[model samples]
Target chain A: MPYSVVGIGTSWGGLAAMRKLLSDLPADFSLPVVVVQHRGKDSDQLLTELLQDATDLTVCEVEDKDPLMPGRVHVAPANYHILIEAGHLSLTIEEPVRFSRPSIDVMLSSAADTYGKGAIGVVLTGANEDGARGLADIVKLGGRALVQDPRTAEIPIMPDAAVKAVPSAEVLPLEALAPRLVALSHEREKAGARRAV
Target chain B: MAVPVAAVPSTGAEPDRQSFKPDLERIEIELLLEGIFRHYGFDFRAYAYASIRRRLWKRIEEEGLSSVSALQERVLHDPEMMEKLLLDLSINVTSMFRDPGFYQTFREHVVPLLRTYPFIRLWHAGCSTGEEVYSMAILLREEGLYDRSRIYATDINEVVLQRAKAGIFPLERMQEYTDNYMRAGGKRSFSEYYTAKYGGALFDQSLTKNVVFSQHNLVTDRSFSEFNVILCRNVLIYFDKTLQSKVHGLFYDSLAMFGVLGLGSKETLRFMAHEECYQQIAPPEKIFRKVR
Candidate 1:
């Protein structure tokens, strides 16, 4: 099935990783990418501006009910939990889970629940294990789970935990992740075209 | 409104059952909401669909139920279940001096405007548990306007409204609140406003002396009074576009000329019908003054 959304979660050392991954994706990349990166509650819009400079695709900090559209990267605002809906995003100030607002587990679980087999969950480098359960949820719902190989991660604890939670997840190096996503985006389209003949 | 358990029609030969399930789930949710509205006086039929759906599923999983329809049956028949569900839906996450920058902006820009008036009437709509209301009271007190200002703090849930009236908060959060206070340009030590009692930080009862705490449903209720300032931060985010427009109209009608309005940091008056009527006062702060 064609994936509808890509939910990414990261924490410490995430900025560099996210910059690399997002910078690599082409301008016309078909899937809508939503990211949850743990940051200080008072952090400014520097992240969005920096990402916008790095990628050709439009990058924005999500508001209350922003639509999930292609050719855009949506970053969760600080101090709110971002939940995935059918074709849009909703935010809540619900108390943080595991002492983390903008919790990866909450976002990924919502994506899994909403998109089912059409969701793609990616867990990158981080010091905490916030995204493991979320990645597991995505896998349980027949969605794809991708984790950075611990050996290639800036901080391996997060990816290590995710690997433990969902061993069947595709583990790629830091440099390989963006390419894999690009290939996945086109794989379905290529298949559809083939069947049409 | 009594929907049978087997109301979800079985899809026969759909090639994409995955896609069909969400549509069926949407129908089940609608029926459940309609039943809740008919059985209970509370109306949530116009809430933001995505947020409400997430909250419903949270309650469903907590109760060990599989579907919205199952939860709806219990909610309609059992008053206790409805109370729990109501709390889940209405309890908003808030903090004292949340988005301190917004409060700072209010002090700098809105305070001067308030000084020109003889008396200030402020409304804190959807004041969850009273943190922001207390925060406002303290700000006014520091500003030397507390004597003439009356705050009407209202919420849809009576449970939270009572808590807001009590003026007690978890002591563990005092440190964070103090930091927020300092950032919001508080003039005095934050600890001076509250005493440690009742297993929490009990705020000075005098803070709420001029404040009226009451239960008011923004969704179904009409505006009760005109005000100089209307603070409905983050409350409209729970509403869909149609409901949001309706509430905006209510606020517009309720505010006197040149009244100030404050919203959550991420919220905007961009597409509302009254967008042109209000001029944004603080750049990027979502504070607006009724101009037209």
Candidate 2:
């Protein structure tokens, strides 16, 4: 399947894991990656700067109605829920679900709703189980679901819960996720080329 | 712009033919919005489509209706359903001193400018539930400018306006609000401003002595007055680009020279028609001074 977007959810130990995954991806990555990393309400743009340093892909904090483009990494801003729409993102200051403002579930579920089979959900290391249900939603919507192997995670609880929710999800070690995504992108490109012919 | 409708899993039917379901749903939503504007005069037609679509679907699900057209049938015929949908649409998720950093920056930057004027006029556009309005009042009081400040707090929904006028907030939220107040540089105990009554935090009435609460639709209403500062944080995110530009024009016309315009943290004046007219006063905060 040709994946259009990637929705990644993580909390505790997310920054280092994100850095590792993002740094390993090629500069010409073919999908827009939306990330929801649990952070303090007043966290600054330092996350964006740090993530940008790790990858050649352009990374920035999402604003309301910001467009989604290939090779861009859009980080959910602090103190808001990020919802996915067709070709764009929307931010809301609604009550935080499960004590998280930029709730991983909200982003991933919206991705599932908008992108359907084109959505890819990735659940990574975190202290909480926020991404479990969202990954389930993605799978239910005929989308792909991936979970970082709990044994390889810094904090395994999140990935473990995700595995429990979607047992059929592709479980990969942290080191292997970037390569898998790159391989998926190449497959998507080949699919697009086939359609063109 | 074509608002892509979310794809529903196709049943044992022609998958390509089922693609038109989203288009039909989109048309239903547009017709519903248009019907609402013509019949009720609430111009939500230009709201950010995705957010509005989510809200409409929420209302639909809550009402146990099957589709947008079904919800529209009820809303048009029944004023009560329309009222409920209005609440859902205009209910902004707001809190006292939301993004406390913005208030801290206001104290450091905007307060000094307000000191120059003998009397200050402030406008809290889309002041849902009045938390930010009262927060501003307390901030002004702490800064010794509350006596000189006149605030006009307005919203598109009258129900929220009434709630704002009451000055009662959930007592359970006080702990959170208190934390926000401290971070916003509160001078006194946050509890001193409110007393527990009616199972809620009934704030001191004096905090709103100069405040005028009214129903004013940002999408349709005209500018009422000039002001020293205008705050419409996180409110315009619901609007589409055209509506955002139009409301920005309204704010531009309403502000006096050098008046400050404060937006939500994520919002920016970039790409705005009046972008070059104002200078950003704070480095990262969305506070701007109308230079032109």
Candidate 3:
């Protein structure tokens, strides 16, 4: 709650991109991170278990009416949307977006509604441009937005679209993302104070 | 940020537009939103472009333009056209007593918490033309809480803000609004609240005595006031989810402790970091009270 709420969207090769961000944040550091990785509907394998192994931050699949906590990462589950309202979180099997559940755009826009500048959007290696405009909204509300360097990304379309939609975003390579994440987390704490002012 | 007109062939050629040329179109929107922000200060750089694209393309089709690039040129030259486009793109379609159940539920479910507060500041975010503001005012009046409340009715579009200020609505729409008003628990006939003029009904200004209509954008703007209740409905669906959370943060910051947050029926506490901060006052209708 004190640090930034980062929303990352990656389609094809997203998990690796997020792992790069997770490995960088210190254990004591407190930022709530939410991610929307396009999930296939019929796949039974749990994404949280998969992502938890990749990050030091506790990765958990979101549930209905779950409270968003600091120092934890929430991933949208398959066949549902992740929404933040009045500070509590909700996961709904409401509708599909752009042909996928756990839509990057749905999570991103809802987060933009909730966090404003407290939200930070990161677009990782992915094939589609689902989160580009939503990430642009993050920047519009004075939140930080980052795109992984497309050239180095295993799948670049997602990051490339984000860069194209949001021209002012910070573009960094995968290796550089972790330290920047830490710095951004700190900057957000200050902004939150300013916001409360 | 203007592109060469030469790159777009002059008007009078085939109306070669089913959709935009993908590559050129993609970059143009980024530039266009930037140009608007820099020149006009109405920041739309963050809206879900897919939605904006659909809206703008509708404008392009109506005006018989070839490309979004072509539409951009006209938008730069014609402020009136831009205003119309702003209305089309930004000022949402609103009806009186929209989600009448939301209001009914607010009276039963949320008003008790409201009654506990002393003087209250309610922010009607995205109060398109003030229909909901009047609706809320009427509700508060019925509950004997009207004098204790001040409603800030805000929207990104100033044109609609003026309409909201006027408190007038098309007379033709009254029949439907009356039904909605009844659903929202209006004790008196809705016609008693407005006077007919200019083929429209100018709603009674008394309902808006405690209201302030202003210009504010959820996309490119910051929080302006601390409020006891923040009502933003049907607006977030146009945004991608990330933008939705940022807007939520602004609302969260703008809310006082134990303030109420009302979202559209479809929108709710999901995926946002502050989900624990509010308790549901009306779960099915999506009205929530900020707990944290």
Candidate 4:
């Protein structure tokens, strides 16, 4: 099946990385995108606004039960774990995983389980090893896993971990990621269009 | 502009592979939650597994235990350990007027209906630490409804309930709370509501004169009375789908006709059995009114 959603995880240097990647998403990006960027407990709506300024896509801070819709970018709120259900998003105050509430692993694994082969997990720039296991889960579930080429990353630790964890993951540079995802999303939309016919 | 950094070759230390056995960890977690429920009656078995496992491991690591079973053994026998674990499980993050927009909507839309009632009973369920309950109290007072309203703020943990009753918050947070209050449409200077004392800001006692702080576990306890409004924000997210539906049913049963039901900013009634029974009073605020 064509992927229905994209799950991205990053920390540390994620803000700039996200800005570059999200800015590249076309306004009609077909798949819903969910992001878990580790942030401080008191971080305000500044991140969402910043990402919004970068992308044509509607950037929103994920609220509980927010619908998974195409063309919208949902960013997990700080200090809460965002779980992806079948067609909606849920937030949890349950303890942070690996000292990170918006743990990349939690979001990736949940998205992997929820979307299975129709999920794409992307591991971007970060300092910690949070998204590696989640990317592994995505790969194990027959989903695509992508990692930013560690050498190209502002913070390489995160993508490096992901690369080691999921050998099959496409390790591409940051600039190459947006085009790759855009192509994947376009393929899925074509598949969806074909199904409709 | 976002800085474009060149990609470096993968040269970091090898990833920290998961050391524990997944099947074993699952068994141990199930056993621990079951043990905790059987021995202490604090049921966490219905909580979502992934998060619960993370929390259990956190407690285990904190206690320097090697496994969930080991943590379970100590918690079952040690009251202090049990208390600590209880804090881990029940302690939720909340703030006064946390989502000012919700409070703003409440003041504008829900207040008029509350004004119509001769006497009002508001239930603040899972009111962890009571910042939100106090916010509601202040709002009621501003609307001139405090004189005839009684706010029952309950939580699963007594530790937070006591803290809520004291009405003392850290001095540093006052600035944030003041901003939230103003955004929520406060009628007067936010500083007028509290005085700094003992390095904390002590809210006016009169604000809570009609407020009752108590311990009530939503998981196992029955609703005590029908309420005009039941505000249980940010608490249900910790529960599994089964428990969330169960609690929603309880709220539905406990609400009087046309009563208000306010949830956390991120929560919704879309998936609940009683979803159609209520009307969304405030869009995107999670405020619903029982219409059936």
- List, residue by residue over A105-185, the lDDT tens digit for candidate 3: 767765565556566788898887788878877777666788899998998898999999999999999888878878876
1 against 2, candidate with superior DockQ = 1
Model 4: per-residue Cα lDDT over A12-90, one tens digit each: 8999999999998788776778999999875778999999999998899987766677767899998788887656677
Off by over 4 Å in 2: B1-20
Ranking by TM-score: 1, 2, 4, 3
- Can you write out model 3's per-residue Cα lDDT over B1-292, one digit (the tens) per residue? 1211112222111112222233466578777777777767777776655456656777899999978778788887888878877877783567788767888899898788889988989999989878888889988988999999999998888888888889889899899899888988788878888999867999888998999898887887789889999998877766656787898999999999988899876566677878889888756668888887
Interface RMSD, all models, one decimal each? 10.4, 7.7, 19.1, 13.1
State the lDDT of candidate 1 residue by residue for B1-292, as single tens digits.
2211112112110112373376788798889888888888888888877678888999999999999889988998999999999999995688999999999999999999999999999999999899999999999999999999999999999999888888899999999999999999999999999999999999999999999999999988999999999999989888886788899999999999999999988887867899999999978898999998
Q: How displaced is residue A150 in candidate 4, in Å?
A: 6.1
Per-candidate DockQ vs. reference: 0.30, 0.29, 0.02, 0.14
The CA lDDT at A135 in model 4 is 90
Name every residue pair that clashes in candidate 2: none
Q: Residue A105 of model 3: what lDDT?
A: 75
Worst 10-residue lDDT window, candidate 2 chain B = B8-17
Q: What stretches of model 1 exceed 4 Å from their correct place? A: A188-197, B1-20
- DockQ ranking of the models: 1, 2, 4, 3
lDDT of 2 by residue, A1-197 (tens): 66778899999999999999999999877678999999998788999999999999989899887777677899999888898877778888877888998999989988776777677899999999999988998888787898999999999999999999999999999999999998877776676667666
RMSD of each: 5.6, 4.4, 15.5, 8.0
